[model samples]
Target chain A: MLTTPIPDAAETRSNATFDAILWALSRPGLPRNLPEPGEAALIEALLDRECAAYAGDPLLIPVLAQSGARLVDLSEADHVFFGRLLDAEYLRACRVGSDLYPDDGATLVIRARIGQGATVRLTGPGVNGVVELQLDGLPAGFWQERARLIRYPMGFDLLFLDGDRLIGLPRSTKVEVL
Target chain B: MTLASLTKPWAPMSYGFLDASAKRELRRKMVKAVCVPGCQMPYASREVPMARGWGTGGLQVSLTLINPQTCVKVIDQGADDSVNAASIRRFLSRVSGAPVTLDTLQADLIQSRHRIPEEILREDQVLVLQVPNPEPLRSVQPNMSIARQMHGDADYGRMWLQLYEQIVRSGRVMQGASYPSMVNGRHVMTPSPIPRWDVPKLHMAKHLTILSAGREKRIFAVPPYCRVEPLVFDDVPYRVEDHAGLTCSRSGAKGFFMNEVPQDDGTSAFELSDSEYGVKSIRRAEGDPVDLGDTWYTNGELTK
Candidate 1:
C-alpha cells in the first residue's frame, strides 16, 4: 500500500478555490461560495509563470506578481481583473480572441453586487433553460456593450464577484437584458 | 526578502506526481474548456512519466483533480483489466493514495479510452476521455490553419457534404467511431472515438465529460445539461452497432455492447465489453449481493 500524501495549506486553498470556480462556470448565473472573498484566491489557484495577467485593481498587483504572472496590457492578457468596472467602454478593449482560438478570449473578473441591480436572462449551454440574474455595479449599457463585443465562440467570459460569492458568464451564454 | 523565506523544504515527489505549477496551468485551461462547452482549447500539454499518446492527457487531468478522498476508475476499450487501464488505475492510487474502484457506481472520477461505461453516471461523477485526435475536421481538411478558419466561419458545409458522399457511395454512413456531433448547437466536436451506442449517452448527460488529447495539445469539455446532437441528414437516422440481441457467453448478460470472439466451429461467441459489469453480473448470478446501477441503455434501447 502506498502512503497518502497530505495536501498542504496552498494546495488545500487552491483546490477549494478551483472547485468553486469550476462549479460556478459549469452552472452559469448560480452563485458559488469561494474559500475566500475577492480575486486573490483565484489568482493563486490559476495563475503561474506561463500566464500573462492584467489587474486594474492596485491591491491585486502584488498578489499577481507573487504568482509569477507577467503583467501585461488588457488586450494581451488572458486573465483581466477589474476591481470594479467603471466605464462600459473598457469592454471593447478586452480581447474576444479569434474564432480559431476562442480560449485566447480574456476571463474578466469584476466586482459587482450580484443580487440587486439590472436583471438579465441567461440561456446557453450550462443553463437549464432560462435563468434570470440581477447584477449591479456595471455602468450603463454594460450588457449591451458585452453583447456587442462577443461574437459567438469569440468573446470574453465574465465572473462577477460579491464578497465570497461568484457567478460566471461564459462566452457561450447569451445574456438578454430583461 | 530573505533567502530562507523564498526557499522551502524539499520532498521526494510532489503530491499526485505533478508539480504545483503544472496543476495550476491545467486548472486554468480546464476552466476555459468547461466555459466554452465543446470549443477546443489549446494548452501546454506537459510531459508525464508515460508516453504522450498513451492516455497522458487523461492521466494529467485525473492527477490534477484527484485527492485522497477521490475514488478513481480507469478503463481501456471497455475493459478495466486491460494493461493500459490497470496501469493508470494503479499509478493514480500509488501517487495520490486515492481509493480505486472497479465499480462505476462508486467512482467519483473515471478515465476512459474509446468507451463510456454502460451505466448512467451521476451528477457528481466526472468522465475524462483520452482522445487520440481531437479535430473532427482533420479528415476533410488536413491543414489545421484552414480548419480553424472553417470552425471560425462555422463552415461545416464540407463535413455535411462528406457525410452525404459516404451515403451515396456506401449504403449508409461508414463512419463508425469518433462521430462528429454538434455541441450546444454551435461547435462540432469529436466525441473521442466512442461507439455509436456511447455517443447518445453524452447528450444532456449528468456528468461532466472532458476530452483531452496530449499529443495534439487540445482540451475540450461537455458540461452537464449541454446538448450533443449527432450530425445526421433529414431522411437517414443515426444507427448504433447491432449488439443488443447478443448475449455474453460467460456471464449470460445480454442487451449491452458485446465483443465478438471467434469459435473453432466457424461461429462466433459474444462476451460483455464492459469487464467490470460482466463481473458484477456473474457475482449476482452466484447469489452474491451486487448493486447494479442504472444503465444508459435499457434492453438495447436508449432510455428517455
Candidate 2:
C-alpha cells in the first residue's frame, strides 16, 4: 500500500486560494472567502515566469519580481493589480485581448469594500436570473467606463478583493448599476 | 534575493505531482476559461505519468485542483470500475491523500471521459471532462487558423451546412457523439464526444464543467446555469438516443443510458452504463439500506 503525500503549508494555502477563486468566478457576484486576507495568496497561486504583470502599487514590485514575472505597462500586461483603483482612466489601457484569443485579456484585481457601496445588478451565464451586489472604492463612472470598453467575448475579467473576501465579475456578466 | 530565500527545501516530490509553475499556469488558464464560458483557451500542456491521449488532459486539471480534502471520483464511459478509471482513481488517491468514492453524490470533484454522471450534480461539485479534440470546426474546416477566425466572427454557416448534408445523406442526424452545441448562444463547442443522451445534461446544469484536451493543448469551460443548445434545424428537432426503453439485464435498471453487449445467439444484452448505479440498484433490490441521489434524467426524460 502506498502512503498518501502530505501537502505542505504553501501547497495547502495555494490550493485553498484557488478553490475560492474558482468558486467565486463560477458564480459571479457571489462572495467567497480566501485562505488569508490580501492579494498575496492570489499572486502566489496565479503568477509565475509565464506572466506579464503590472502592479499599480509600488510596494508589490518586489513581490512581482520574486515571482519572475516581467513588469510591463498596463496595456501590455496580462495580469493587472490595481491596489486601490483611484482613476477610471486606467481602465482604458487594460488589455481586452482580441476576438480570436479572448484569454489574452487581462485579469484585473482591485481593492474594494463589498456589501457597502452602490447597488448593481448582474445578469449573465453564471447568474440565475439576476443577482444584486454592492461594491465601493472604485472611481466615479467606473461601470460606464467598463461598459464602454468591453465588447462581447472580448473583455477583461475583474476580481474585487475586500480583506479575505473576494467577488468575481467575469467578462460574460452584464452589470447594471442600480 | 538570496538563494535560500528564492528556493525552499527539496522534497521527494511536489505536492499533487505537478510543479508550482505548472499549477500556476493551469490556474490562470482556468480563471480565463470560466470568465468566458465555452471559449477554448490555449495552455501549456505539461507531461504527466499517463499517456497523452488517454485522459492526460483531465488528469492535469484534476491534479491542479485536487487537495487532500477533495473527494475524487473518476469514470470512463460511465463505468467507475473500467481499467482506465480504476487506474486513474488509484493514482489520484496514491498521490494525494484525497478519499475516493464511487457514489456520484458524494464526489466533490469528478474526472470523466466521454460521459457525465446520471445523478444531478450539485453546484459545489465540479466535472472535468477529457476531450480528445476541442475544436468543433475541425471537420468542416481542417485548417485550424481558419477555424479560429470563423469562431471569432461567429461564422457557423459551414457547420449548419455539414448537418444539412448529413440529414440529406442518412435521413437523420448521424452524429452519435460529440454533437456540436452552441454555448452562451455565441460559440459552438464539441461536448467531448459524450453520447447524445448525455449532452442534454449539460444544459443549464448546476455544476461547473471544465473540458481539457492535452494533445490539443486547449481548455474550455461551462459555468453553472450556462446555455448549451445542440445544433439542429427547426423542422428537424434534436433527438437523443433510443435507449430510454431498454432495461438492464442483470440489475433490472431501466430508463438510463446503457451499453449493448452482443451475445452468441444473435441478440444483444443491455447493461447499465453507470456501473455504480447498477450496483446500487441491485443492492437496493436485495433489501440493503441504500441511499440513491436524484438523477438528472427521471424516467428517461431530463427533469432538471
Candidate 3:
C-alpha cells in the first residue's frame, strides 16, 4: 500500500493562496484573505518558467526572477504586477487579447487600498446584483479608461491587493464610478 | 541564487501526484476560466494514471485543489459507490490524504460526472465537472477554426436553427443530455453530459463550478450568481426530464431526479439518482437522526 504524500510548507502556502485567488475571482467585489501579504504568494502559486511576466515595481523583480518567468514588456506579458499606480498609461498598453483567444489576456495585479476610496458600483456575472466597493490609490479616470479599453470577453482581469486582502474585477464586471 | 535556495529536498512524489509546474499552470488557467465565466480556456492537460475520457479533467482540477484539510466527494452519474467513483475517490485519498466523505454537505470540493448534487451547495464549496466535449458548436460546425470564430462573434444562430429543426421533427427539443446553455449571456458551453434536471442547479447558484475536458484540453467556468440560460424559442419553454413526480422505490424519497430501473413486469421502477441523499432518506425513515441539508429542489420544484 502506498503511503499518502504530505504537503510541505511551500505547497501548503501556494494552495491556500490559490484558494483565496479563486474565491476572489469567482465572486467579484468580495474581499478574501490571502495566505500572506503582497504578491509573493501570487507569484509562488502562479508563475513558472513557461510564463511571461512584467513587474512594475523594482523590488518584485528578484522574486519574479526566482520564478524563472521571462521578464518582458508590459504589452507582451501575460501577467503584469503594478506595485503602485501613479498613472494610467499602463492600462492602455495592457494586453486585452483577441476575441479568438481571450485567455491570452493579461492578469493585472495592482496595489490599492480596499474599502476606503472612490465608491464604484459593480454589476456582473459573479455579483449578485449591484455591489458598491471603495477603492483608493488608483489614477484618476481609471474606471473610464478601463471601460474604454475593454470589449466584452476580451479584457484583462484585475486583482487589487491591500495587505493580505484581495479583490478581483474580471472583464465581465461593469464598474460605474459613483 | 544558490542551489540550496532554488530547490527543496527530494521526495518520492509530489503532494497531489502532479508536479509544482503542472499545478501552477492549472492555477493560471483556472484564474482565467473564472474570469471569463463561460469562455473555454485551453491548457496543457497533463497525463494522470487514469484514462483521458474517464474523469481525468475533473481529477486534474481536484488534484490541484486538494490538500490534507480539504474534504472530497466523488460521484459518477449521481452514484457515490459506483466502480468509477469509488476508484477515483480511493485514489484521491491515497494520493493526497484528504478526508473522503460520501455526504455532499461535508465536501469542500465535489468532483462529479454527469450530475450535480441535489443538495444546495454552499458558497465556500467548489464543483468540478468532467466534460467529454467542451464545445457546444461541434455539432453545428465541424471546423474548429470556424467554430471559434462563431464563438468570438457570438453567432449562435446556427445553434438556434439546430434546435428549431429538432422541434420541427420531434415536436420538442430532442437534445436530451448536454443541453447547450448560455453562460453570463455571452458564451454557450456544454455543462458536460448532465441531464437537463441538473442544469438549473448551476444557474445563479451559490457555488463556483469548473468544467474541464482532458481529451479536449479545454476548461470553462460558471461562477456563483452567474446567469445560465438554456437555449429555447420565444414560444417554447425549456423542459427538464419527467422524473420530478417519480418516487424512489428503495428509499421512499419523492420529487427529485431518479434512475429508472426496468422491472420483470415490463414496468419501470425508480430510485434516487443521488445515492447519498437516498441513504440519508432511508436512515431518516429508520428513525436515525439524519440532518438533510436544504436541497435545491423542494416538492419537485426548484426553490431559490
Candidate with best TM-score: 3
Looking at candidate 2, what is the lDDT of residue B216? 96
Candidate lDDT values, in order: 0.90, 0.93, 0.94
Ranking by TM-score: 3, 2, 1
Worst 10 residues of 3 chain B by lDDT: B295-304
Task: Give the per-residue lDDT digits (tens) of candidate 3, residues B178-271.
Answer: 9999999999999899999988999999999999999999999999999999999899999999877899999999999999999999999999
Q: Name the top DockQ candidate.
A: 3
Cα deviation at A42, candidate 1, in Å, is 0.6
Q: Tell me which of candidates 2 and 3 scores higher on lDDT.
A: 3
TM-score per candidate for chain A alone: 0.97, 0.97, 0.99
Fnat of candidate 1 is: 0.68
On residues B170-253, what C-alpha lDDT tens digit does candidate 1 reach at each position? 979999999999998888999999988899999988888999999999999998889999899999999999988989999998
Residues A1-178, candidate 3: write the lDDT tens digits. Answer: 6888989999999999999999899888999999899999999999999999999999999999999999999999999999998788779999999898999999999999999989999998889988999999999988989999999889999999999999999999999898
- Name model 1 segments beyond 4 Å from true: A1-4, B1-5
Structure candidate 1, residue pairs in collision? B178-B193
By DockQ, the better pick of 2 and 3 is 3
